[model samples]
Each structure stands twice: as structure tokens, then as C-alpha cells.
Target chain A: MKTKERSSENKICPLEVAVNSISGKWKVPIVWQINEGKKRPSEFLRGIAKVDRRVLNQQLKEMEQDGILTKVSFNELPPRVEYSLTELGEKLVTILWMLNDWGKLMIPAEED
Target chain B: MKTKERSSENKICPLEVAVNSISGKWKVPIVWQINEGKKRPSEFLRGIAKVDRRVLNQQLKEMEQDGILTKVSFNELPPRVEYSLTELGEKLVTILWMLNDWGKLMIPAEED
Candidate 1:
């Protein structure tokens, strides 16, 4: 895949770029599933409760394009494919955990 | 502020919650501005390029609702206000830095 085209500004905010990379509706959950060792599309389909196949595919392709995922297609009888988090993707998972923790603090404690 | 209403599901994904909190167009920029010690609305306006006052106000309100910022009003003749990152908001800054690092990896190296 080609390097992402830089924006018009000579200086780009890496934080914005990072946020944009995972902006898709299903991107976070997709990363979660893949991080959990669910590699194939079918596995991802089952792992993320409400994602449709087409949308899932689109996010997967975008993640691949962004270098967050590495896709391998096995030219076997059924044409098997697998996805894994690239180094960047793994780094994001660590950050995502931090975000999840931040989110938990916002959630109200359960009261009867 | 009232705790955020829980979604339909008995369980909520904290990662999604965290992502949604910062989903607004000017949120990250707003955070960056506040992080850099720009406390007032006018200061944020000057710090974030291309953001209008109205949109900036809306995003600031949402971030406040999400507990990412604390807003205080001083009812003086001049009407003063200030904003600061809460503890949760401070945690987000740490995570944002990590995301920034990850994003830097995706940016193409400059070539002569």
C-alpha cells in the first residue's frame, strides 16, 4: 500500500491522523476482535455483535490501507484470508486500553 | 452534571464510550488548546485555527458533559469563564500522546 498523502498543511497533527485512522464505525471493534486472536472475516463477523459483512470488509480494507493491519490471502481451495495487527495497530491497542479505562471513570457506579 | 444515561445494553463498551466522548469535530483541538494552558473560550478560538465560536462552544459543552473539562463562570461585570482538564481529562492527555506517537509511524518519511 502507498504512504498516506499528507494534507495541504506542511505540518500535520499526528493526533488528528491517529483519530482519523480509526474513525469508522466498526474499526475499534474490528481491532478488538483481531487483537483477541480472531483473524478471519468469519471470526470477526461473529465477534462483533452488530456489524454487517460489507461494512466490516470496508473498515478492514481501510485499516489495511492505513498500515494498521496486515492482510494475508491464502490461495487455497476456498481462498482463505487472515488479518493481523501491524506494529502500529498493536501500539494503538495499548492506547485503546487506556481510553477504555478513562471511559470507565466516566460511567456512574451501579446503584440499586 | 448527571451521569450519562446508560445505553440499551446492560453492558457498555468503555472504549466506545471514550471514542464517542471525543467524537466532535473540534474536541481534540479543544483538548490540545486546554492542555496547552489556554483556558478561556477566546483563547481556544485563537489556538485552534478554522474553528468558529459557535461550534467551539458546542464541542466545549459536550466535552464538559463528558467530564473531560471543568467549566466555571465568574458573574462579574465583564463575565469571566475558564476551563481546565479534569482528572479523567488529564488521563486522556496521556493516551492522546500515545496515539500521536502511533500516528507518527504511519506518516510517510519526507524524501528529498
Candidate 2:
């Protein structure tokens, strides 16, 4: 019984970890924007309304550290930077698509 | 261009709504417990650590309103109550399973 209980707890951990990893207010939006091919910080600022630079940068850095994003800085006069989804990040996008479909189910409930 | 942008915005809305609905700290854990056949409130409190009665009740009420759960009350000596997943909630479990798989990908990153 103890072993079974521990196994159940272990099963629960990944879902909690997954939710926590993407639980940041701007994290999912940032990932969605990148998946849509908007690569730069400036584009994200424009695409997602009301997210200031500092918070956006913090979320971006966290996602990068989490291996969901790869940040590339180009040496230039203006010092250009771009972010793209890594393999793990791409996998997350596929799951988000499933979530998006599931979310559609709740829209009618939300409207009512 | 404006119409296209509007379409894109609509696409984003459902995922945001979905995230908001389940974003409650104890919501997913509560759902997991129910899905595991632990139906009573007391069972959830014991299974999930650190959740107080008030917060648990609030999350349960919100989920019931959102159509993710159905609450039943039995009239008896002490009034038994139980919660179970609605069809929408079961659908969400399917998506969460996918999310759980995606989360496993990040475990290696998290370990390092």
C-alpha cells in the first residue's frame, strides 16, 4: 500500500511540474507568440498587449533556462537578438494545441 | 490584414480561457484526486497536503460552476457529499495526460 501510494505521488509530480513551468503569466503567451514565428522581444511586446519589458525579459530568461527557448544574440550595430523554440519547446507547442482544443469545449460554458 | 489579425486573436483566446479556468493552485490536484476515485472533500484534504477547508471549498465551487465537476449531496444522518468529473473534465484529463508527457521532457533540464 505504501509503495502504491508513493507511485501515485510520483505520477502527480510531473503534471504539477509541467503546470508550474508554464504557470508564469506571460510564459504561455510568449511560447505561443514564438510558435507563431514572432521571434524578437519587440515583436512579443507588440503581439501581447500590456506586458512590459522587464517582466517579459524575466519570463524569457526563465524559459531559456528551462530549455523551452534558445536565445541568440547577433553582434551588430544595434545588437539584435532572437528567440526560438527548442525541441522541448516544440513538444510543448503540440501539447498546447491539444489544450487549445480542450479550451474550446469550455467556451460555451464560459459564455453561459 | 485587420480580419487576419482578429482571427489570430480569436485563436489565442480559448487557450487563455482554458489556462485561467484551471490556474487555481489546487484545482488540478483536486481534479486528479477525483479522477483517482477519491470523491469526498475529506479525502481530498487528506490526499493533498496544505489545502485548507476554505480554499478547497472555493476551488471546488468554481470548478463546479465551470462544468468541470458535478457535485452531489445525499440526505442522511450526516449529509454525504461527493464530487465527480463531468464530460468536459474528463476531456481535460486527456489533455493533461499529454501535458504530463511533455513535462517529462523538462525533468532532465530541471535535474541539471
Candidate 3:
């Protein structure tokens, strides 16, 4: 829908749409770690950044749906899966960096 | 929190953080309407975009809390309230536009 129509119908703002695209709870850190060169599912599970398997899988699936990343599975013993970003997904990191900068400036009101 | 520490602690991703900053459900639309020159709260409530007062008020309060918008109230008959972006809030719109562009491309899987 056009922006005008979208607003007219949904009443949920543009910011919410932006939020919905990546609001899977675990999507962000997964994307960040992937960008930082953690390519394998196991690597993502390990490391200092640890997302619960169920949520991680859900976010990974959603990211693939968003076309932000692609998931490729290998037909090997025990099976292996790898997730990587599409060009569009990679482009989002630059914008995300700006958001990160904003977050840093806005002091968290409470310790989370 | 530092991105690394944030990940270690929350396990939610940076993409989620990006989403959280504006995830109030009604925030983006309100911001979009404001940038389109709907400065008055009533005008925002009106227009083709119809947001429920409770959700709008909640989103507005949250935006003010986020430093994305400042709420100016005039203590007069019927009380006048105006919401406008801070310098940082203004800066966020350009990035929001990028998010809008991405949404346009991501065909909604289902009609809402």
C-alpha cells in the first residue's frame, strides 16, 4: 500500500513497520554476529552472544523471509546449515549503525 | 550496554535493538504524519490516518520519552498540546525513509 493509504488503514505508524520487520526478539544480535563473521549456526549459538535455539531458529527463518539473509543446508551426515545476508540485508547494517549510535546517545532509563 | 555486552546479556540482536527504538506500534505513523506537517495532536488524530486516542497518546508519550519528539502543552481552555521532533528526531526521518523503502519491497505475506 502507498504510504498515505498505509497510514489511513493501519494507524500503526511507519516506525512500527520498521520495527516489525526485525522485531523477532533475536533477529538483531544474530544479524550483528553474522556481520561480525559468525557464519555458522553453531558459531552463532556459541560465542559471548547466545540466543536460545528456538528463538534463534525463528528469527533466522524470518530473516530469510525478509530477504535479508539466505539459509543454505548441506545434505551431509548430521546436516549443516549456514545463514548469510543478501545484498539488501548487508546494506541494512549501515542504517543499523546509525540506530546504534542513537541508542548510545539515549541513555537507557533503567538497567535491562 | 556495549554491543558485545548487550549481546552477551540479552541475546537479542542489534536488529531487535533497531526495532525497539521505534517499536511502540504507533510511533512511525505519528512521526511520518508530523514530518508531513501534521503538527497538532488533533490534526494527527484526524487526517486520513486515524489512530486510536489511547494508542496515539501512548505512542506520543513514548516518543517524547525516546527524545524523538518533544511535547509542548499550553495550559489554556481545552488545553493545547503540540508535538515536534527534536534535532535527533528530525535526523531519524531520513533513516526512516530508508526503512519505508525496504517495507515497500518486502511484499506483505498476508493482507492485514
Best by TM-score: 1
lDDT of 1 by residue, B1-112 (tens): 3345544443688888899998788898888888998999999888888899989888999999889999999999899999999988898898889989888988897675
The runs of at least 3 residues in candidate 3 whose Cα sits more than 4 Å from the true structure, single-residue gaps closed, are A1-18, A47-50, A108-112, B1-18, B47-50, B108-112
Q: Is the docking of candidate 3 incorrect, acceptable, medium or high quality?
A: acceptable
Better of 1 and 2 by DockQ: 1
Report the CAPRI category for model 2: medium
- Tens digits of per-residue lDDT, candidate 3, B9-112, equal 55544334446868766677788888998888788888535578887888888888778899899999988999898887887787788777665556554455
Q: Which stretches in model 1 have alpha-carbon errors above 4 Å?
A: A1-10, B1-10
The lowest-lDDT stretch of 10 consecutive residues in candidate 3 chain A is: A9-18
Candidates sorted on lDDT, descending: 2, 1, 3
True contacts kept of 1: 0.77
DockQ of candidate 3 is 0.28
| Residue-wise C-alpha lDDT for candidate 2, range A48-102, written one tens digit per residue | 9999999999999999998999999999989999999999999999888888888
lDDT (tens digit, per residue) of candidate 2 on B17-64: 889899999999999999899999999999999999999999999999
For each candidate, give the TM-score of chain B.
0.88, 0.85, 0.74
